[model samples]
Target: MSFIQSLKSSLKASLGSKQRQVSAVPQIAAKASENPDLEKLLVIPVSDDPKEEQQRSHAFNKGQFLARQERWEDLSKIVNDEDQNRRASGGGMPIAELLCQGARADVVALAEHLLIDGTPEEARPLSEAISALEQILGEHSNNHVIATIVAMAHLDIAWAWRGTDAVRDTPARNLEAFELHCTRACQVLDPFCGIELDSPLVTSARCALLVGTPNAQTRVADDYEDLIDLAPEQQRHIRALGHHMLPQWFGSYETLELEARRTAARTQDIWGAGAYTWTYFDAVLVDPYCARYIDIPFFLEGIRDILERSEDQHNANLFASFAAVSIPNAAHLCADDLESCSALEQIQTAAQWIMSDYLHELHPLIWGHAMEGFDNHARIASIDALFKQGREKANQVFVRIFGEQMRKGNALIFTPQGLYVQQA
Candidate 1:
């Protein structure tokens, strides 16, 4: 069988009794060419140096080969050993990525082994590997990439542990690990303020107070409650700022007006007023699939509002993670000389220009995320495929916007830290 076919078989075997059918890999591959947005979303960055690229390619392929052969022990050893070398070398790919790749591969091997051996003890090493990865990630409090990868690894390990005797016995340990991963993620990103700061003075004062306040425990509860009480309009505004405005700090009078109207209309719904509070997370490491919407003006605007509302009232630093997705060709929108085209094209052009400006302004933070490998092309493609179900049209528009941005090599401004526009 081909590599993709083997992968599908492995996934099916692992998810046995779960009702999900394997997605058609050929169909997914075909979609990229048929849709420009899809193509843009799938672009993975290649190393500039041919030698390094070849090595990475070879390593990944070799890892996959070991997985197919069901050499679980050997695969684990290879990845674990490589991880140690990677740390020592300080190579291009972050430690988190290396760990994740290794862990994911190891998990696949373990799953295959379990299918035959059915030994719970065999899974223990996988858990240990994941824990080791998390411990390393936790040590670096400021490294968002490591934190995110660790969090994801923890989640994966937790999922893998589920339904087993191990999980039933040590639920608290799993929960604690998961919580620690999230806590670390929050700490890594807290300085970036995943929400907009009305002004630098306000932001600075808030940060200072947070640092100085000796008894801030009582304030978290009140702040949480305040966030819960915000009107839908206020929440919507927060969401807008969280999603768009903060990512690029490009909100104009028109953008603000449109968001305000949308928020008002949505708030009129009895259930909509505070729904964003429950739905949005404080610190999310966005997947590639979710990253496509990062450049959409309306989407970013909504995210902004949500993030602002979620932050601690006294300090915007107590914020969520709005990490970017990595997909092929997923970048901020840019303008092109398509003025002679139809009216729709002209409108798209305008939107692209607006998005481009926003992304440019937030380049520092956004590029940082990309450099850390938080968002990329493959992840974006996966997200595009996943979200094409209920919100097909909206996601398609996002795909287009992202594709345009990628063509220009413009990094997305998808984090709150990207929103603070310094005055010249």
Candidate 2:
């Protein structure tokens, strides 16, 4: 039997409850036959028809969509084909000229794909992506999306080369380049209302470039305060991200947790699974350096309370519980065996264990999506049935089926657009 099927069988045997009529559930299984990297969650859907002049702008969006999905190979193929086609038609396409979303998708795809791969050959493509983005910005300096994307590309290039032999030769120069991109992005984004703390562009850039800098704690906290008016879900995401980012810049754990409590209190959704905040929260706990300051069990107990009070709970709660149960022991394991205990390895192992033991009794569809290497779903059931089974088992299921998913390689890519963005 499949994982969930087996779990149901066990439940019937143990509880002696009559067989409940099972129903179909919305399956969150990603593309089964493909590697997780090619999967996407399209966030900003584009119109099918576009004016000739609108094509270039649309191309950028399409590229971003592909990039978010992490479809690197497809993106590369499309970019190459478009470049060849454009050359055959008329080789003199100006960088400043806006292409339809179709054309822009090629350039955006190249830039983002290079960001995740981190190959030495990526240098040329990174430069090309920036140049194209710059051209777009030159003509449309006020365009926040273009400016933000340009900044993201710059940061990605910098991240791709960090600690590399080439960049190590003059690290300061490389950092300066990143700062320049940030400055450029902020020039366009800062003038817009609610972009500083709210924009993915600004928040992500700050986390990447500014996190380790001096006095980042104060600035990040201030940003949180400004974001209070946003919906609780957004606030939780930003705050949780802040929790992860602040400590690197010397933010106090006590202070950070205090803020987190306040944010938690504001949320009507007790489990806080509405966003990917739990991932960030779990990430903090997994850090050995971070564990010294946190009261692991205490922190988890609070989460447990949220889960208990949560109206509609799911696998996220179980994932959180699994982390709470497994992380401390995992940390000890890592401390004992440094070779095996890399942060990514810790998360991967935790996920595997959760699949095998905790949610292992549940459906592959319920927690299979939660596991790292496993993608193919064995079955699907009703959302209500999943919840019912989850309640019976004192577990729940969650759908983190979209938004930016980071792979084990430490490469981050945004998923394709969906009704629910995970805010990763």
Candidate 3:
């Protein structure tokens, strides 16, 4: 029996209830020999379409090339384009966000290298890049877009210097460097803080600065609130709000719950109850202890609302994979504490209706990323291997859930257009 299946069997024995509870994790119903036609299924993962992939590639490559060549003016134009603020049709990510990342990818990577091991030799390139960026800022002091890029570069380097170790563990010299970089980052962006002057880049830099700011604990919600309001279509901002509101970051569990609801109301016009779902989504993924705090019915309702509102298959696959794989994995990790935990069991059970009602096509990249909670440093042998692993798992999930349909002379096919059935 699987972990959840074993838990269910135990529950039934203990409760003495006549009603059967479905397994949250799929319970394989029929043997493979019983369904020889399953091998012909076409349920592998795929992108939304090739054209959207090409467009995303073009945007990133062009922006990175502009940044590498130091054509700041040209890069500014792309970031300032109205389309940049709009969410991409392929996935919900903001186009301008990618442009900003491309603009500072070189500097940020160097800073990240210094953050990890702090080798003196690794610091030279980062220092040189900061100096060059600082000089350009002096020449174009009033250009808010240019100032935003430099601010983010400094902000990242600041984190690199401070590192994630506790205060006592951090060296005094590193603390001083962290402060110096943070100060410079704030100074450049301070004048552009007003609403009229804010752009997507400017708003992002402000949010990033909250880590080093003295007033962050009280201001985390406010800063993110401004961001979500500016682009209510962007669910990423709402997701981030829940993260910073966590007890370890700026707020307590109560604060996280409150902010999730507040964001739901605030963005109801755009996301409906989806804002609440996105807020709690990443937090619980990274730390399952937070799962204990989730309001089961409300959270599940938010999930339904999200799938109903968003047409993007990426999101449908994202939540489906998250529920079926990620959250159940969390439950397994905390199995000792979960046996009597009814809420956690119900949370795991949510995957069933989500897969049945919402999921149409598979996106292996999303499923693969969920296996590691989308960690930046999750080790993988190769992209092809990652997708292959994800594909196999996804097929297992679908076969278990839709097995009856498959055995009855129907082949489930997931194309970019949508889910289709072939008569077997």
Q: Going through the candidates in order, what is the number of backbone clashes in each?
A: 44, 32, 0
TM-score per candidate:
0.25, 0.46, 0.80
Distance from true position, residue 316, model 1, in Å?
A: 25
Cα distance off (Å), candidate 3, residue 339: 9.3
For model 2, residues 1-424, the per-residue Cα lDDT tens digits are 2222332343333334333333354443333323333234222212222232144345555565654454434544554344323221111121121222332344433433443333444356445445645665565566444454455455444443343221135557556755565555455455544444344323434444443345655576555544433323232344345445444444655665555555554553534432223423543543444544444444444444444443222343345334533454445644764543454244433443333222212222223222221111223245445444333222221222221242232222222221222433
lDDT comparing candidate 1 with the true structure: 0.34
The digit string of per-residue lDDT tens for model 3 on 141-205 reads 88777888788778777777776422347888889998888888888889896357546557867
Give the lDDT ranking, best first. 3, 2, 1
When summed lDDT is taken over every stretch of 10 residues in candidate 2, the lowest stretch is 88-97
lDDT score of residue 60 within candidate 2: 58
Local accuracy by lDDT, each model: 0.34, 0.39, 0.69
Which RMSD does model 1 reach against the true structure? 17.6
Off by over 4 Å in 1: 1-59, 66-157, 161-424
lDDT pick, better of 1 and 3: 3
List ranges where model 2 is wrong by over 4 Å: 1-122, 163-177, 195-209, 212-215, 235-246, 268-280, 292-298, 305-314, 317-330, 333-424
